[model samples]
Target: MPEPHLLAADTDRAAVVTRLDESLADGRLTLAEYEDRSARAHAARTYGELADLTADLPLPARREPARREPARSPVASALHGGAWHGAWGHDLRAAWTGWVTTAVIVVGIWLVTVLGSGDLQYPWPVWVIGPWGVVLLARTIGERRSQDTDRQQLPA
Candidate 1:
């Protein structure tokens, strides 16, 4: 550790002030005591002076590292849990349901036009379906690859 007589940086002063704030919040220090200590903390010129401000206070509790979870796209969350968590298949099914529903609606419209005109209309629904299907297929492929990668990462 560096010598306590060494000059303190703004960060050192700020750390001491933060502890003073916490002490005040916890009712360990009255407002007058906090104001005095905080003013002294900002004016402190050495690590030793800063340390004196909190020397009698208990150490702050250690904070746990936050847990990591898989990142999900907005579309994926809507499918998996944003609408309702754990009641459906993972994001995959929800993603496809949208494309399938739209495809059915567009095809039904095309069929109606063909019947009314008594002639084959150009298969127009393919315009709506094809690109969307390709996108969903690509997303499915990526999702599968990620699942495979996750499975491999697990210990045998």
Candidate 2:
């Protein structure tokens, strides 16, 4: 048996219908599509029938629970973990890469201005360009940190 909160039948069916109607009225759903699906959902007598009405809608793919048994070998476990782990690791690495690349460019410009035979002066091109590089690096890092914080706050 499922928990009462998890059962659709235990919910306010009228409220669900009202939400669907609002979606249609707000242009989130086309009138023709809404009417057709709403009619199907209304006429449904069983859980399966109601599910079928919205089966064609795109939904976020669910992650399958890991198996506890040894039906799968150790290699399968390693491979499964590696796929998603690598993707998240790459994302984190890219953020650092951006910061490092920006810093290198800034340093290169500063060195050229100081060591090279050029009139290095305040309010010059290098002064303006150098700080912009650091600003970009800070912005990228801050944005990524904020996004990570937001993701952490969301319910899994």
Candidate 3:
């Protein structure tokens, strides 16, 4: 069942080896069969010879192409200090702003209720603000530790 016509003049060693491996992996070849075919494939002289090695094997679905990292411009890379561009700074600032907004809103509501009642009400604002304050504190500490780690990792 080998397509003898598909075999041509130019064939490389890698192609032959690949086909033999495929045959082995596809279970078309037992270990002994693989070894024998692999030897023959290595000794193969032309494209036809290599094609014969895998002619009986079924082709598997193609795999996704490998990922490659995005290329960075030299000037932009230098300007951003390799790893300092976004790391934690923007996030920390936003977190602080969020905490301030929450605190102001809770206190404003609590103060209105207290003054309107003509007596100091229970400090109920603490209930709303305490949990948010704890969350922001933890986040700030985590960011500081992470930045310290990143700074340590940088080359001398």
Candidate 4:
């Protein structure tokens, strides 16, 4: 490793800014502190100056490269949809839950209105539910297509 007192490169400054941003997002630092540190990082001229801003923070975690597996069991593949799908599944599940919750609430309100009027009204809740469901479906399809494209481009 180089000496901390040495002049810093643009990359070094950028790294410090990224750390400050992460700290702010994780509630480790207040917005004011993050702004101050970020500005200092951009103006930093030496490695020591940049290091000082993040001295109290823990080191960032290092990510290991993804290891491609040759095959998955039929059940595992069906449940998880291979590697990329498994990674995106959690996010999709959350979005699906949100949609379901909203749909139930909207339908409940519509039912209450119909009972109060003593007549079946036009299903206005469908206007809210239909477009949202379509958008979610489109997003899922788009992501699946993107993952397929990525898998095809991978080295065999």
Candidate 5:
């Protein structure tokens, strides 16, 4: 690397200003000193002049890149229709089978209750089935939208 005194003033001035900004915040530089140093930094023509402004302050730490979720695969979608058909480790087919089996059990109880009483009663199964159906509908819509979004953005 070239000596600090040999570097161009304007090229490294931002780095010095940033350090000066920190010094001001840390009470190392008063408002007057900060103002004077900031002006000198911008007007500096040599790297030596710029370096003089914040020689006492440490350099800012380097930042790490952000982490993101793994990208969804098209092959996974084509094979599965949707990746999550079941909660936990179960597939969609199993989820549907479980739901259907539950519905049958609920209806069977309602039927036996009505028959035993020998009186007409409201179809109370609607309360259970109605909400279950709505949840399925929402899941289906969300999956469709996700698939569409995947289609729109081609992987680089």
Candidate 6:
């Protein structure tokens, strides 16, 4: 008959494998580390050995503790100090494209309006069309860039 502890350990192995898998998915453990640790966990024949594998992981840290302290980066400090802060992380090319498109649409609408009626009036088409198109294009570009970065990081 199998020892009760051995049976319990075998059952607990599934939980350990689950935890290891989650860590691997979240990038906390590299692929190699995950495979090695998973193999060790699977080979463990006793509850004590399984427990030992998880002994080093701390309980999750509280988010409140992190939020209580103000961020100390120079950029953050400058923002807090009332310095003129431009939009951080904005792609200038994206912004320029958006502005240019907006301008073009506005001009096109103005021309249409002038040809239809000889009056300077706000163009609704410019407001409706330009911003969304530019935003979509920028998001597509950003997604591709992020994918490229991920591909580069993967072990060749």
- Highest TM-score against the true fold, candidate: 1
User: Candidate 5 at residue 86, lDDT?
Assistant: 27
Range of the 10 consecutive residues with the lowest summed lDDT in candidate 1: 81-90
Tens-place lDDT per residue, model 2, 1-156, is 133334345243443455555555444666567667777666655555555554554443465985444354557746764222222332443444444555566667767877775765453545645665565566556556756876999999
lDDT (tens digit, per residue) of candidate 4 on 83-123: 34544443665576567768989999999999999999999
Using all chains and alpha carbons, the TM-scores for the candidates as numbered come to 0.43, 0.26, 0.42, 0.42, 0.38, 0.34
lDDT of each: 0.78, 0.53, 0.68, 0.80, 0.70, 0.63
User: What's the residue-level lDDT of 139 in candidate 1?
Assistant: 69
Q: Is candidate 3 or candidate 5 better by lDDT?
A: 5
Task: Kindly report which residue stretches of model 6 are placed more than 4 angstroms away from their true locations once superposed.
Answer: 1-9, 60-156
Question: What 10-residue stretch in candidate 6 is worst by lDDT?
Answer: 82-91
lDDT of 6 by residue, 37-115 (tens): 8899999887777776666654443546423344467776567742222232234444444455566767786788888
Clashes of each: 0, 0, 0, 0, 0, 0
Ranking by TM-score: 1, 4, 3, 5, 6, 2
Model 1, position 118: C-alpha lDDT score: 100
Report the C-alpha displacement of residue 15, candidate 6, in angstroms. Answer: 0.5
Candidate 3 vs 4: which has more lDDT: 4
**Range of the 10 consecutive residues with the lowest summed lDDT in candidate 5:** 85-94
lDDT of 3 at 74: 66
| Each candidate: RMSD | 21.5, 20.1, 25.0, 13.5, 24.3, 18.5
lDDT of 5 by residue, 39-140 (tens): 998888777788777777676667697565455676775577656532322233334444565788899999999999999799999898778767776776
Q: Residue 68 deviation, candidate 3, in Å?
A: 13
Best by lDDT: 4
